[model samples]
Target: FSYCAKDLGLVLLAEIDEAEIFKPIAQLKNQIIVISIIISSIFVGIAFYVSRTISRPITKLRNAVDRISKGDYNYKVDIKSSDEIGHLGHQFDEMRKSVLETNRNLNMLVKERTKELTDMTNALDATAIVMVTNRDGRITKINQKFIEISKFTEKELIGKNPCIVKSGYHRTEFFEKMWKTISHGEIFEGEIKNKAKDGTYYWVKTTIVPFLDENRQPKQYIAIQNDITDLKNIEYALQEALKRDKESAEIIKRHVEELKRTNIELRRKDKLKDEFLSMTSHELKTPLTPIIGWCGALKTPRILGDLAPQQRAAVETIESNAVKLEKMISDMLDAQKLDLNEMKFTIGEVQVDLLFNKIKKDFEPLLKEKDIQFIIRAETADIRLESDEARILQVISALLYNSIDFVPKTGGRIEVTAESRDNNIIFCIKDNGPGIPKDKQEFLFKKFYQVDTSLTRKHGGTGLGLAISKGIVTRLGGTIWVETEEGKGSNFYFSLPRKY
Candidate 1:
């Protein structure tokens, strides 16, 4: 500093102002401090933004984990960013879907297996003489059929040895063979003769199975048996029948001619009965026609309009009875025709709705008298069908008439419907009446089968309506059946092909 000062100035006294000297230095220092503060602020803002973006998805993932850990496989994270967090969420959803699918599959498998087990159990319970025993051959479980056939009480059979029913016929070796086969996890099948508690003999075709555990050692035994006593009796009878065949040969030869004569007589009698029925039907219908026509004419306003109600009631009663008699005669005639295979039909296209309307009109008065609610429902508008309109309409009318006899005295409901199916038209007649019993339902369409036959029976019908209807339906390439339960109601259904 002394050499440089000597060169720069003659008197290097260092004359300087303290205020101006540090001015630029102080400005630079302030600028550096301001720059540092700005940089720090920018970094702080970036850190806050990064934390917000990163922590939000992490927080959501944590919540999802909590829910999933609580067995909520349906919970999902909503991370949509194109980052590792989004990938994790996607993987998590896939895992959850797999878990749910597994759960559903397991549940379905359980249901299916349980249903199969139940069905198998029910089948075994019904058809077989089922019995279960432990490895020691003590009776553990037995079905009602077993108890019934053995004539042993449940108390006597439980924990009892199966030898209680041992018949002396089978040798001890036979049973030893059976035990040997079954104990070794093999099946033993044979004819078994067991003594009942009453000391009577019964035969059974038996199959004994040894139920094995995972180690392949028998844990228990299951015995299924079928009562073959009848078969055995039949076999014994057949043996006796063979021995008697020679003796019966001469007797059979002697009776053959007589049987032939009897058969011819029977045939002649049947023919005569049919002829008489035809003639009787014709005779009855001829006279009844005039009675019905005249009574109907009298019922009109122009004929007997001024008659008192009670007087008119008598006339109407005669008319109704005559009509029913006519129906019975017609039914007899139809049955005769069917027996002779002469029931003919003029098949043609017919309007079903028109037929229904006509039937409704025919039964309208009777229905109104009975106070029955009658409805005809045509699901297919202006329903046209290719069939014998006359016969089909007769069936409808007969069903309606039959329902009239069965429906309640008042407020009974009868609904008739025709629905057009893909290939056929279904006709249904539903009646709110005392339904047919289950035992009688099978015979409903049989000839001369009536549900009520007591002297005080309120319903009146020839019992030929359903039988004739069934025949007509069969001829028309259709089927008919009734759905009913006692104390409920009856639904009669008939299906006819669209082209018939």
Candidate 2:
């Protein structure tokens, strides 16, 4: 019984020890299960918290970002946590605020720019002349200037055809060309004359531009015009005046030509008169020459007896009258020949010394009668010059006669000088007579033009000697001129070219 009881006690003790070990192990397992359950619950709570905090805010941010991508700048995220997830939410919230602010500023800038553009457009519309038209060739919009000029109000012009103010001044061709140009979307500029509402004509320089639509078709035409009626009127008046002035000038020219014809006829009549006088003088001289020759024969000792003093005086008078009559005939003939250009010249070389000697001898008698001294000074004794000898002699004779007539009987003198200058022989005849007047010098060599007509009558000349001399000198390829001052002596010069 003791052994059995001891065995039962050992078994009990082993069972109790096993129970203790199993209980502790089971308690450890239970504690482990409880701890795992608490940890899993905590993890689930953390996951829920993270999901609510991070995932929810992130999702909200993603939605806001999506909205922003679709141009919705008004989206926002609500993330107000304080952990790491909260921090992420805070960052997303800050990003949303920054994006929203940027969007707000951008919108404000766009609004400002849009407002500015709107103001500019409104200002341009108000200040500039704007006209719009529909595609139907009708007046739609007109500016203030157009309304003022057209004598039509905006209400009167709108919806009205442009032909309402056409004025009917332009022809159909004008409108045809205008239509053709504008229909092709071209711009045309021209001046147009139109009748105003008051029935008065006016002008406008106009420019028409065609507006095109998207299909490249002409949609409307805009015409801008300014008034130029006054300028047109002024130009028209000027053109008319110019036409009248041109007509008057033509008439005056015709009258002047008629007067010139009449003057030419008068000159012909004068020439006929000169020719008649010359013929008459010659006719009278033919008979007088014979009479004078018979008188000379009567004075000869072999033919006439001694005469008394009174007879001698009468014969002398007849002789003197005959000489005067012969001089008048010669002067008339010379004047006629000079006027008709019928006088001929015999050109030849004449020694200067011989010419001077002949002139001195010929004038010696006249010089002695006037009690005046005549001088000849030659630079070269053998100087020979080409000239019409007889004509030159006649010129010299006439000059001597003029000097004798003009010079004072007591103190005046005449000088003849010849010299070689510039391949020509120059001869000068100077006299201490009263010089010609300034106004008369230009006409000194003109036909029938004399310094003193009374002097011409008293001195007995045809008033053509100097003119003939000038013609002769010009024909000989030489020149003749005179230099004189009032109250100073006159020097007459002539030059003849030297032979090579």
Candidate 3:
């Protein structure tokens, strides 16, 4: 029984030992589960903390990059970490600053360029020149002055060739030369006559320059010009005026030479005229002396008593011819004296009626011989005037004699009338004779001008009667002229100042 009890106790002790060992294993397992739960919780907390720190800043940085890409430089990433993310933030800020600064400078540069272009345009406008042409010689740009000068707008000139402004004044070769010069990257300066849009012509001093491209080829052209129409016109007018002045000067010089030649010829003719007058006077007087002497001697009874009828007729003819010759001599002397300006006048008050009666009686015998009817009409009786008595009588006698000589033999009549008008006494002699021709009237009072050259020979008298009468009347402060129409009679009138 002791051995059996001892076996039980050993078995119980082994079971207890096993239970104890199993209990410790169970506790160890429980402890292991708790430790795993704690470690998992700690690891989860650390993961959440790391994810929040990294993800939040990374998300902010991502948003900043998005804003920057969209040209928004104002956005910045806030990363407080002391790692690469902070360095990246700094770099991002710096990049944003640089981009902003670059943008600002670009905007400023654009503004400055815009202002410079505006200033250049304004300067071109003031200068009245601005033009741009394309590669094909078409106009592309035109300024305000170009519009004003051409009478065209920018739209009109654009796409139009420069030939559209041609005035046709220049040859085609001229434009060809200009094109050749400008197309070779050369500048051309010349005057061009161009037509405006209104079809009027204008002169322009032009400078054409070629616009070159990167390859040095002519891509476009610019033409600057100024209107010189008025200046050119003034120069042309001056040249024309100078040419006319030169022509006029040549003509005047020729006329001056001609006048000098004419004066020389006139001087020689004047000398010849004086010599002819002296010779004519001497020849006329030489015949008058002997005839007058014989007529006076034959009138004496002691030389010849009771002449026969035929002899008496001869003596009367001789006496009458001698008297006519004596009168002609007196007229020639008077003409010479008047021509030399040596004729003297006796100014005094004269009885005009008495003078007229004496002249009428003196011409009565000649009128009787010619069978001419004479009538005297007076406006007033004894109208005295201030004049030379003998000179006045001489003028009246000469005029009466001319009237009798020209009076037609078939129907001859003379009428003498006197009147006082204004401050003058006018005496008129009207004769029924062949009237003077229109063209012959101006020379009627000229010395040696005979209306009827045949009448001078038939009447046996010099043609100096009316000439001497004109001179005497002129000296007496009077004027004489004839009024007549063709186929009508002549009226010779004289006016003497009454108060002279």
Report lDDT (CA) for all predictions: 0.88, 0.79, 0.85
Q: Count the backbone clashes (under 3 Å) in each candidate.
A: 1, 0, 0
* C-alpha RMSD between model 3 and the true structure: 25.5
Candidate 2 local lDDT, residue 82: 70
Instruction: Name the regions of candidate 1 deviating beyond 4 angstroms.
Output: 1-245, 297-310
| Predicted structure 2, TM vs. truth | 0.51
lDDT (tens digit, per residue) of candidate 1 on 70-114: 988888668887788888877887888888889889999999999
lDDT of 2 by residue, 1-500 (tens): 12236655653223235686688889999999999999999999999987887788778767866887897756655667677765765676687778889989999999999999999857745654445667778888887866656676788889987776677878999989987888888888888886545566667887888889999898888876777879999999999998879988899899999999999999998988887887898898888887788778767777878777788778878988988778767766876776677878787888888888898888888798888888887987788877777877887777777778877778979998999897898888899988888888889788777777773455556677677778777767788899988788788887878752
TM-score of each: 0.51, 0.51, 0.48
lDDT at 262, model 1:
96
Pick by lDDT: 1 or 2, better one: 1
Once superposed on the true structure, which residue ranges of model 2 sit more than 4 Å away at CA? 1-275, 454-458
What is the alpha-carbon lDDT of model 3 when measured against the actual structure?
0.85
Instruction: Indicate which candidate wins on lDDT.
Output: 1
Query: Which residue pairs in candidate 3 collide?
Result: none
